[model samples]
Target: MITDMTQGNPTKTIIKFAFPFLVGNLFQQLYNIVDSVVVGRFIGTDALAAVGSSFMIMNFFSFVIIGLCMGSSAVYSFFFGKKDYVSLRKSVFISFFSIGIFTIVLSILIILNTNNMLLLIKTPQSILEGSQDYLEIIFGGLIFVFLFNACSALIRSVGDSKTPLYFLILSAAINIVLDLVFVVEFNMNVEGVAIATVIAQAVSSILCFIYAFIKIPLIRLHREDMVFDREISTMVAKYSILTSLQQSIMTFGMVCVQGIVNTFGPDTIAAFTAAGKIDSIAYLPVQDFGNAFSTYIAQNKGAKNNERIHEGVKSAARTIIVFCLVLSTLIFINSENLMRIFVKANESNVINLGVEYLTIISVFYMLIGFLFMFYGYFRGIGALNISLVLTVISLGTRVLMAYVLSSIPTLGQRGIWWSVPLGWALADSVGLIIYKRLK
Candidate 1:
């Protein structure tokens, strides 16, 4: 289904598109959210800490795949909009196989050194083996994760968001069932959770691929459409490499931040783990909105609908602001209730510290809302270099300030929470200035 998003009511189109995207993101995150809840309640905070500790490392690799998908989607959406089916087919061929090969190689390399990777992150001794168990299974299934992500993004890029949402609902449902069976019935421990995730991803990727080839005429490749185009490949690589670098920088900084959090003792680890889970849920809608905005902008840009892009983005900003204000406020007021969902009842220190962390971070939701929109706009229009610079600024400030403030005798772990808002403030301000300057 090739949708020309260039001609609709901009606000209604974005709203219609972003709603399914948001639902898909929620289903997508069920993988992590379920993993955290199951680990915390059934296996204890040590196991939850293990999963949380390894999360950023997992995200760094996910960054590589997502970056390429984002880059390819921007180009392909433009092609789809302009009815350039030949080049669109070529982009599809290259993106699918190239990402598949890269992820396979990356999985092998990471699987070979999973233990050492955990050690490098200063994974606490109590949770080290659990982390190792989780990372190995996930890395081994990297091909499925990478492929599913790319395929889903491709589907949405052409304005087929509901299809992916359906695929994800089935996938998330399977993962939840398998999580219970593996963890409780089979007694695979933490390894079970990872295996469940991998299996679910494999199923989703296969189904999604089958559906696309059979159902979407645009995805079907003809013999003439299979040739490699060096010029297009170069353009995609240019956007993807810089985009990947931008995300890699941010995740790498989080790994460093994770390492720093490890030094603050197991209490901090448990609290941060719980807080991180809440943060993921809270941020998901905005992230989904940003992704939709990117595709919307790219499709319109391809049609030379500059004024439409501007009008749509303005409406989106208003919606996102309302969303942010409402969510942050709810989280702030009920921060303790939410913390209790992940941290066990006996861990009062973890609950208190989790509240502190969430309370501090939720206050800056408005900044993050703006930052995501700007990132999407830049990525969609091929202004990826600016996006890259903004990411570096955000991550650099976060890591530096975390170490600086946390080292203070008075601040202790509290400073780490404070550093988040401050870093977000700086990055959002920079992103706004950049957005204003963009023509």
Candidate 2:
């Protein structure tokens, strides 16, 4: 069992709690990276690009639920720290119901307009059919993704990161094997890969829910406890909707960025995808730490331990800065080699483009670390409005920059790519300023 309260040494406590989560997040990204590698190797570069191209679109839907998950975790952590079991259960139930409704509705909407959606994004004509097939299967199983994320978030709220890691590692391993069987052995194409990915998600969802159902007593709610509680529901909805709006805007902006990348051709698309995988690895630890700190800070805040909350901030900032320095160095040094490892030189032009993006972004990776840390920190403290404002600034700037830069003759696609780091630097600076006053 992972420990929740940091009795002393907040940094050590957060690091310990976050290690399993870091591993879990890495394993999750592994599914994406490995799936792309297998498809690029066995099927073709076009197939790889098709799958990668659809990621932000998929995330657009998923992030709505993710917002609720993040919001619920903060609420649950608050209640759990106060030992208010009734409210905790209510929060959980309302979160599930809300997310369930949203997932079903959005999945249906995406499935119904699949062709139009793909065309709207200007998906390549050659790969459009494949992308549609992938989206259909993934949307069909969106509930699995929602439930898994909700359950995992709830569990982590109480400081049990290990269970989620267990499920992720198991499912990720299974996903890789299934990918080989479906795509390579049976020649399933993009649809096969997509199906395998969802099936694996289903398995993780079922296993994690079952574990929570049996072990987490809070989950076994009575009709009274599970009944819609207006106050809790309102709180969850308020924060979640705000968070969702911020994320939706961010996702919409990325979709625009994707459209820009698409215009650059498959080489740029494939390169962006491969570089993104490496970037995910670099940021994983800070993300996990931020996650852990969010719950830690929320719990401490609810308990009215102002000192503990401040301690957590210091610990998180220190850890994130160090993490940024280390990962940035590694990514900067071996970026070219990292891109090459994902795909063969003869098959994909991803290597050169990936190297360029990685090199440019590495300079601002530390800024991202600061941004995510403070974002989580504010969220944990129920300062959601502040977090949303930072997101608006960051995302708004990025989109405007991406739009203007994408038009420039000299910058072209690279200009869109540069927007990410620039946005991070600007956003983190603003976030840090606000956090300073709050601290």
lDDT of 1 by residue, 62-125 (tens): 8877777778888888788777878888888887778778888888999899888888979899
State the number of backbone clashes in model 1: 0
Error of 2 at 95 (Å): 1.3
Off by over 4 Å in 1: none
- 1-439 in candidate 2: lDDT tens per residue? 6355636688887888889999998999898888888888888888888987887788777777777777778888888888788898888888888788988998898899988877887788888888889989989999998889888988988888899999999889989999999988999999988898999999999999888767988656778877787888888887677767766767777776787788888888888878887887888788778888888888888788999888788778787777788888888999988987777877545788899889988877788788888878888888888888888788778878988898899998788778898888888888988988888
Could you tell me the TM-score of candidate 1?
A: 0.97
> Candidate 2 at 413: error in angstroms?
1.8
Give the per-residue Cα lDDT of candidate 2 at 117. 77
TM-score of 2: 0.97
**Candidate lDDT (C-alpha), each:** 0.84, 0.83
